[model samples]
Target: MKVFGFAGWSGSGKTTLIEQVIPEITRRGLKVSVIKHAHHGFDIDKPGKDSWRHREAGASEILLISDERWVLMHELRGEPEPDLDAQLARLSPCDLVLVEGFKAVQIPKLEVHRPAVGKPLQYQDNPAIVAIATDVPLDAPLPRLDINDPAAVAAFILQHQGLI
Candidate 1:
């Protein structure tokens, strides 16, 4: 799968841009998957859910299936947090995979930036950032995009991955 990343500071519109672009990319009939990285703890399974109970009961892996979908939860009891590559390997195959965050990892990526926050740009020296999506005017060396233009962003990704 062709992997790309969306990275930026808090409230810089990374998620917003991705949300807009996903459906358009999918509409083009390409299989796309997304991986969103969260720094804080999050829970998809509630305490009383059967999957949660199974996990609490020490099942290392729990598989829940139905007619429409299936969910597999792998408990990380004592293992170190896996890196982006390992995490990507676990996902189902797709024509393209858009990963959000993991800014330090080397990959083709778009740096979502909003200068209103007065933060410095991440792509100033980060070659991994192949393009930038921002709400401000920038004279940076790399390609710049308007954060609200989802079609343009999708076009850049598709072209970069040769999916067009």
Candidate 2:
């Protein structure tokens, strides 16, 4: 499956843009999966939940199932966190994988930038950033896209991935 990414500082709207872009791309008959990286500890299960208990009890992994859905939770247990490649392998095959972070990973990506965020543009130093989406006009060698336009952003990603 092809992979693309959205990289930016926090509050630059990476998650919001992805939330809009996913449906836009899916409407074109493509299957999409997302792999988001978080800097802080996060949990998908509640503290008092059975899945949480299983992991707390030293279960390396927990597979919870029901008629509605199924979820698999894997505990690192002091092991190094899995890298991008390892995380990608865990996802079912799809037409495209939209990675929401892992800025250090070498992947074709668009930088979601908002000048209001007061962070410098990453594309200048990151070869992996092929273009940028911004809320205001900006000058750069790479293509500049309107950050609020999900259709345009989705098109850019599709074209970048040769899915168009």
Candidate 3:
């Protein structure tokens, strides 16, 4: 799948922008998948669920399947965290895969920047950053976008990847 990353500081609207853009991108008759790198502990299974019990019982991989969907949850179990490429290998084929974190990876990236967030940009050292979606006008030579305009940003990403 074509991979793109959204990089920014916490609360800079990276996740929010991706959430808005995914539906619009998918509506254009393309399949999309998201690989979000959680910063802290995240629990998808309920406490009393069978999957939860299985995990608690030391199962490294707990997969739950049904008629419509299936989920494969793998516990790290104190092992080294998987890198971006390794995680990409686990995803099924799709038109695009939007990664929410992993800014250090060399994949093409879009910076979700909000001046109000008061954080420095990650694009200077990251040559893969093709554009920035921001609330304020950026002084850099790179393209800057209004943070509310998800369609425009999504379109830019698609065009930049030559997927449009």
Candidate 4:
């Protein structure tokens, strides 16, 4: 599967933009998968849920399946988090993999930027950033795309990855 990424400071709308772009991409008949990196600990299971109970009882991995869907939750158990390549290997085949974090990883990415976020631009230092999606025009040499236009952003991502 082809890989692309979105990187930016917190609250810069990376999640929002990805959410909007996913539909635009899928509407074109290509399957898409996402890999989001969380800096802090997070849990998908509740305290009293069976999955949670299994995990609390020292289960290293929990696979919960239903007629509709299934999820496999693995506990790190103090194991170091896997790197991007290892994580990517776990995903099923797809047309594209849009990563929401791992800004330091050497993958082509779009820098979702907003000056109002009060954070500096990442493209200056991140050579993997092939373009910018911003609320306002930037003075950088890379292409600038309007953040409000999900279709355009989707197009850019598809084109950049040679998906279209």
Best by lDDT: 4
Candidate 2 yields a Cα-based lDDT of 0.94
Provide the overall lDDT of each model, using Cα atoms, as 2-decimal numbers: 0.89, 0.94, 0.90, 0.95
Scored by Cα lDDT, where does model 3 land? Answer: 0.90
Per-residue C-alpha lDDT of model 4 across residues 1-164, encoded as one tens digit per residue: 99999999999999999999999999999999999999999988999988999999999999999999989999999999999999999999999999999989999999999999999999989999999999897799999999999999999999988988
- Taking every candidate in turn, the Cα RMSD to the unseen true structure, in Å, is 1.2, 0.8, 1.1, 0.6
Count of clashing pairs, candidate 2:
0
Using TM-score as the measure, which candidate wins?
A: 4
Candidate 2 lDDT at 140 equals 93
Q: Per-residue lDDT for 90-137 in model 2, tens only?
A: 999999999988989999999999988999999978999999999888
Q: Estimate each model's TM-score.
A: 0.94, 0.97, 0.95, 0.98
Off by over 4 Å in 2: none
lDDT of 3 by residue, 1-164 (tens): 89999998899999999999998899899899999998889898999889999999999999899999999999998899999899999989999999998878888899888878888887897898988899887798789988899999889889887888
lDDT of 1 by residue, 9-126 (tens): 8888888899999998999998999988888777788999889998999999999899999878777898877899898999999999999988888989999999887788888677
In model 3, the Cα lDDT at residue 164 comes to 88
Instruction: Give the poorly placed runs of model 4, Cα more than 4 Å off.
Output: none
